[model samples]
Target: MNRTNCGYPLLFPRQNWRHYALRSLQFAVALYLLAFFLFPVGFLFLKALQNPDGTMGWGIIALLFANPVSWESLQNSLIVATGAACLAGSLALAAAALFWKSDIRPSPFMELCGFLPLFMPAFVLASSLDIIVGGHGGLPAMLQNLLGISRANASLLSLTLIEALHYFPFILIALHLSTRASSPQAHAMARLGTSWRRLIRQVFVPLALPGLAFAMALTFLKVIDDLATPLALGITNMLAPQAYHRIAVYGAQDPLAALIAAILFITSGLAWFASLGFIRQNVNLFPVTFNDNRPPPTSASMRGRFFITFLGVVYLGCYAGLILSSLAGVWSHTPLPETYVLTHYLKAFRFEMSSLYNTLIYCGFAALIDILVALPLAHAIAKAPPHWKQRLGWLVAGTLCIPGVTLGIAYLALFRDIQLPLSNLPLDATGLLLTLAFSIRGLPFALHICSLALNSVPASYIEAARTLGCAPAKIVSRIVFPMLRFGLLLAFTLCFSLAAVDLSLAALLVPNENNAPLAYSIYLHIQSPSGMNVGSALAIISFALLALILFGIIHRLHRRQGSHRTLSPPLFPTHRTTGFAHESSHH
Candidate 1:
């Protein structure tokens, strides 16, 4: 060996093991993400870019922009989305302000009730809205008829109302946070000999602006991207739904749908970026404090209270509409149906049993397996030194940015041509492959939830176990698993819930009827004639199944949380670092 200034260093080559390991991990993550999300999207974009002769060209894009029909549909979509966002944002803001800021008697439950719309299927909501709008005999339409309005006029109005009602919770959560985050110091300064208008303009609005923007951006994305609503509302010939139709019904004709999807890919990406930008620019730096020298509480007048009560009543009525539609025998055009039957439930269950079975198998297995794998992955990611942590976070973050449909397509592009033989097993079965896809899709989410739980773990306990000579495996099993069970349960339940209802990949991976999930099966039923009753049944059954699962998960979670709250020790101060440091000085 050659002598050097530092002779010890010259004895061997220094290994940068962390860099090598991180690079390898990043490569694996990239491969999985591209296979699952990027390639299929790129493939479609490739198709969209080609001419009939298969040469790369923008002729398809040109044709789409030049066509009035496509423009009209696109324009209609934008207009409707704008209306929905404004209405939803306004309602959410009002509700959040009224409930969260004030000494409202019923606080948390009201907030929870407002979030019910999220659980609703787009088609089911549309169907319920339709029944309410058949309002020549319906309440709103009857009132409008008394004022001498036409049925045509009512449809447009109904669309706005339905969308607003369904989407307002987005704004409520956002604004509620904004309201809460307004530092009491800021409010105090504003209130001390300041004009009310100036106080709101300077203190409240500026603080709340970020929340408003977030809510609006999210609301806009939902309204614009929704396929079921537009289709159910008979706007299928429009841009967004047309894009869907090209994939589902009209793939043989022109490839306009690909172009529209490409547009969505670009636009939604830009929107998300803009939203993130706003959030980054405006996030509060100061600590948010509860109002002290409590601003004298205000109460709504009797008339105002009654008005709020009426809004609540209407909300309950809409919820009832969802329940009744699921059970109705035949919803004749009436104010409200007087009769109902279980035929819808029975028919749907019989028709969708196979689909339900397939979906359950895939979702349940994927979720369970994903959580199992993610435990190690998340521990590594979370517990890694700061120098390495960001690589793992960024790798997962990239997957999160890609839309589900795009990721599904990536899997198609990557795996479509590959074949394998592994230990006498067939390397590719549709069900098994789909299960893998679902699991891969959920990795980012699993990583996120588990990492948060892992981060919360007190390192002292871990060190104590090590000091007692515990093995790594034993330490993880005995100490870590029990502490983080609630988070894992949440991760699995959330993952399963998402996979159970998803239809984004249905077209790409599920071709045969037997492979259809509940959502896809219902979509198929609705696409054909004579599927209304049975379709409603399927929709309702799907809803019921989802509801039951959700209830069970939440109930279990609540029990666990209650146990933690009751059986666990009271809170104590800790340092923010060294893996949740305990009080060094015993008090």
Candidate 2:
């Protein structure tokens, strides 16, 4: 008998090799998720429960809740989070609605204003506002003299407004996309004699709820988990800063810090779960078609144009103090600086080069790792069976609940004693751990884009290639990779930018000041009176660098496509039935 035809062949048959390869790939992905994500987070929870004698109990958690400061911090975090979400959502909803009704074409400058906050760190916003309104700020004396407002009260008010301003774009983008998706319905309703109010009440609200809920939930999580902003504002009573303080002062092994991190984790997870519930209820809202065939406006309404311009100007005006601080020589008590100079910029370049380099190296590696893992994970989810697809999608989405501080704490706790190969240093002592943390944090974003890209590819093309007996490697390299190049590029850019601006992770994960990322370095500089100008200069440089990188990537992409295609706003996935629903069913 031929060995190949035997019931038990020595080697696997050629036809079944692909199946084995796929199984191996799935196994590898599962292992990676467990090792990098599940274990660290799980250990953090365990650390919070463990007693000093190594016994497992709830004593630490109980002690945490028993403290009045902890209760106060928790209450403050919830209040701030809720308020910021509402404010951001309201602003975005109004802006999006106005734009939709007027059909105004946004200028490139307007577009930049709307999206600029996404590329900046929240602390930068907080600091900029402080420079304008703090006790020793340029405008505080002037404002106090004219408006009868104290700098103290203004600083308090600015904290929430700063967060709201920084995060509103997320909701704005979501609302814009949802409006486009539901435009046909709106027009249909309008043609049937439906009033504007009724149309908004019935069709617009329901269609927009999924996107709004997801975006607002995201905002809430961001505000609650934000460490640098609260710290920069000198508001250490919030949960994030409290946890950071405990870890920084008491060491990573502090039980109170672990408990506080646990609280933050639970709170974030609950918020995310709530958003998913809202998304589930509105699963049928999105239309499959993405194109908008409406004619470009030849002349926008004067009122609409004025409103757009006013908002753009006001938003950009918030950063005026930051610009001046970077260039100002002195005259802090005046409305403007006495003299302008390049000394701050020169100092930033001289002393902060290491910090800037650290950011690029760490965030760049993290982005690379994100795309590498995201491609296979996205493909696997697309090809999974219905039940498994939902499970895998949720598993990936769960990564968003892991706050940066919590993840950093988990890394320190879980990997503290694990020595690196061929080195005496522990894993937590090197930049590798920081890069890995960033990768885990950014995986969900990368996966979302990758899945969308993979969904765009025609199944028939893949099936035909398979019919020709092309190997999986050949299919991916020859066909899939070419189509996925743009999406991969976008994923990398998003991950890199997000990581670079992550002050929370950098604050907690850096082993020493020498290895600090630019965000942390800026924070340190700002804390010193003499170094404030240098910090402001560094912040501007960071902003410019990120903007240039993004512009270059987008320009290159445009040239490659041989068209002036603008970027499409990113869409958030609703529950199992909307975004990934199509992905799962595409095959």
Candidate 3:
């Protein structure tokens, strides 16, 4: 028997080591999900059932349903969510179909327009729209004169439209990706003399259904979970706002708040479960291909381009009030500000620097955690057996069903009595808990992107490295990391941005005003008449900073790609390959 240094046996030693390492990593991921994600949420449900006497019962839920306001809130939430989903889905489908079926190309500017909403908080958009049309002023006056509608009706319409606008991009992106995935089938059908309607129905629709369903479901969930938008619009007859009211007025220890959160969780979970079947049908087997050799653009294509540009302009125009408010020195009952100054911006930096610091510390930590956890988790899921793969993937995706407010409520309930190690302060009161909440909330997104990144790397590269006696860590560091750096950076940026704008969690989890994150601080500022300009200033600053960061990251990644293309190492060295082959032959 031949023995290697520090090895018990050489026979299948690599296999043994690899198996243990994989198992250990999987176990670690499982433990993390259980501890941070499952445990807290489970505790919330349990707490909702706990009676004042410390016995388990459904009395809290019974009480919740008994209240007329609660029932109305539930109905309103359902209506808004469903309406927003349908509206957004319709717009996204139309835009996607036009781009896919027509000669019109989606410009980078169009893509940026779709992506912009993801970084903007729902409340910010709601507030901006309110400024434009909330009261009997400006756009609202003109609309009322033209349409003859009451202010109350207009408010409700604005709320629904705001939600739809904020979420349409999700469906658009999904449909766009689905089109790419189904391109080959589409081309084949076209070549076979298929009718336009038949090709669309048979090839495009079926392939896009999964993505469409998932996106609609996601939009519905987001709308349902949104607390800030309703609150900002002064629409309290919604589930999220009601839940926040319960907590805010009755405190975190309130059983009714827990009950409302539990209901929200159940509602979102059902929606997610309904969409799971569609999600499971998604298959990506080919690279995305575009019609690069198309003929000259026609009138229809020109119309399509014009329509897309119009949509982008309209969406950006929605933020005109916000931009003006940020720059305004004074304005009262006017279409625009009377004077413009940098005073608001100066005030935001002077007094709200702590909020910025807190946001960076909390969201930055969360994004880091997401990348670290998602990298291994994505790899493990990719390597998992088919049955386990589906299960693990759904499990990660299920995090979407756990709303930010639900998680925040859960953390407050679960960790109310739990203290940080060696500290007298409760665990729920610290920024650590907030960071963990952000991580859990952002994990699904990070996981999805990381999975895509991992899938892009060929399996043969990893296997070759292993066969060349490179350790798993070395394989990832040398081969996987280099290839995945861009994707990882993108995931980090996305997670950080998402976490930063998450007003629901920040509202519930913020320890105090002094330590509040920027989103929560902005919310506070918006609530005050004197602070409205400062709030707008803060929002604008946040947006500009995020945009600058994203631009820098993209530029860096592009530069790195160019450098790598010109001066990169061989993916697999010839000498190492020969040695590995020789060793295999000897064995």
Candidate 4:
């Protein structure tokens, strides 16, 4: 009878200690995630069920289906997302294939151009696209005069072009990481009689499909969650802006947003789940044994090289417009526009301080904390009984497919009336809420990266250190950690960049202007006529900060690799890594 009632009644003291410690840690992290990211999402869903008199009801969801506008917006969002995913996925596949398989003469410069979008924030792309279309002396005006096409007719296509360009880099990174695993294999196969097309279809495509699918899912999430482009493109029926406007202007709090978000979450989550299961089934299908004896030789033809450079230039031109526009003389327009000025930058720095500060405070703290929690979890996962490996792996990546808005909504729901036992602080404090949100949001990415890093650390090292009578701390501080620095740095940089640009949750949860971050600040500035230049300037400043951070990371990695030159073959077998820190690597 006692055995049924008491969990530890028959347990050994050491076993009890280990079990309780692990469970306690798990409980704490789970609570933290739910409190900041999941609960608010639940709250939003609950709100959708509530009646107008604050009573629980399904009227919100009913209104969503009944209203054509709401349904239309959701439909439009799906269309746009699908289009962006296709364009991005195809382009990334081509570029990755070129770099990975063919003896494509490596173009370091072209690589830089191709990846410029990685550094550009979402709002800036939207703004630049808008300016290119609707602003005074913009392309629409020229097209209207030359081709006799109306500006209204040209604007939608123009915005789509801009979004495709901006979203492409996200898909590209996933493609790059996915294909890197295949490139070496494909190269060796190319030397055989297998034709390029056949090799691509057989070896490269199947192997890289995982990355491609992952990219598409991520792009879908990003594009669907986007709030800036609709405003820039002037599409009121776009899903993101609709949800934004619903809460901000309508005050109606339509339950449809919740239903739509649930749909999005379910769809993407299923895709990611299927992909992970596929990956696990095939993780070792291609044993990674290398043909070091016969590495593939490339025959990059002159025409191929030229085509690569041309395509790279086209990619570069998209973001160059923003880089140029951000620093443009106020009146300049058209091809090869006049002198670049620093005045815009000076103004930007002056005005964007609060937003910049908030970005740093939140991203820095949250990413760092996420890493600390994650490192332990990763270590445990890596060391867990081998039987649990595949199950736990998917368990971690399952969070990737969760919709961004759902996480934001979760935070809102969980914290509405919740309080801490010690201090009576409300969860509504934007900074606190933001820190938690960012951390929980970052968990999936961080966990993925850390798991890979930890797995790469050979068990032999830990075992040898233990045999030498080294303490657990000593072993970790020495062997395990030294090899993990690069991965941890990569994880932190990516998490920071993401948090810096995040607008959805911050916009919804952070009510005070004083507590606002860069994304919110830009959103507010863009809301008013007087604030356009200031907003543009602020946007440019945020872009520069992101770029600088990226540069600093690359510089550090170079320095680290430089010192390890004697042992490690080389960091840049091809010096074509992009500037964006997030785009640098998978692990």
lDDT tens digits, residues 1-587, model 2?
11211111112234687767766776887787789888988988988898767789977777787889899889888888888899999988887776655555454333443455556778777677767775334333444566678765444455677789888866776666656445545556666987767766765666677778877888888888888777676677788999899987998888778878888999999998888776633332112222335555534345567877787677678888789899999765798899999999999999889998998899999999898788778767766665677677777877787788888888877888899999999887899889999999999888877777777555666767776887767887997778778778888988888888787888888889999988889988876788888999999998888778756654565465433233342343333233212222221
Q: Candidate 2: what lDDT?
A: 0.74
- In the range 264-284, model 4's lDDT, one tens digit per residue, is 566666656655533411221
Clash count list over all predictions: 5, 0, 0, 11
Checking candidate 2 for backbone clashes, the offending pairs are none
TM-score for each predicted model, relative to the true structure:
0.74, 0.86, 0.85, 0.79
Native-vs-model 3 lDDT? 0.74
Give candidate 3 misplaced runs (Cα > 4 Å). 1-25, 134-154, 180-203, 280-294, 466-473, 553-587
Q: Which candidate's TM-score is highest?
A: 2
For TM-score, candidate 2 versus 4, the one ahead is 2
Q: Which candidate model has the greater TM-score, 1 or 2? A: 2
Report the C-alpha displacement of residue 300, candidate 3, in angstroms. 1.4
Q: Which residue runs does candidate 2 get wrong by more than 4 Å?
A: 1-22, 105-115, 134-157, 181-193, 280-300, 466-472, 556-587
Root-mean-square deviation of candidate 2: 5.7
Can you write out model 3's per-residue Cα lDDT over 1-587, one digit (the tens) per residue? 32322121222244577767766876888798889888988888888898767788977677778889999888888988989899999888877776666545464333444566667688787777767664313344445566889865555566778899888876786677656434444555666987767766765676567668877887888889988877776678887888788888888888778888989999999998887766434422111222355547866568777877787688678888788888987788788889999999999999899999999999999999999899778767655565677577767778788888899998888777888889899987788889999999999878877776766565666666667888767776898778788778878987999899888899888888899999899988876778988998999998889778756754564575434421111111111112102211110
Q: What's the ranking of the predictions by TM-score, best on top?
A: 2, 3, 4, 1
Name model 1 segments beyond 4 Å from true: 1-30, 105-118, 135-161, 181-203, 249-256, 280-312, 330-333, 349-351, 369-444, 507-509, 524-529, 544-587
Candidate 4 TM-score versus the reference: 0.79
User: Candidate 2 has what TM-score?
Assistant: 0.86
Evaluate model 1: give its TM-score: 0.74
Give the least accurate 10-residue stretch of model 2, judged by summed lDDT. Answer: 1-10
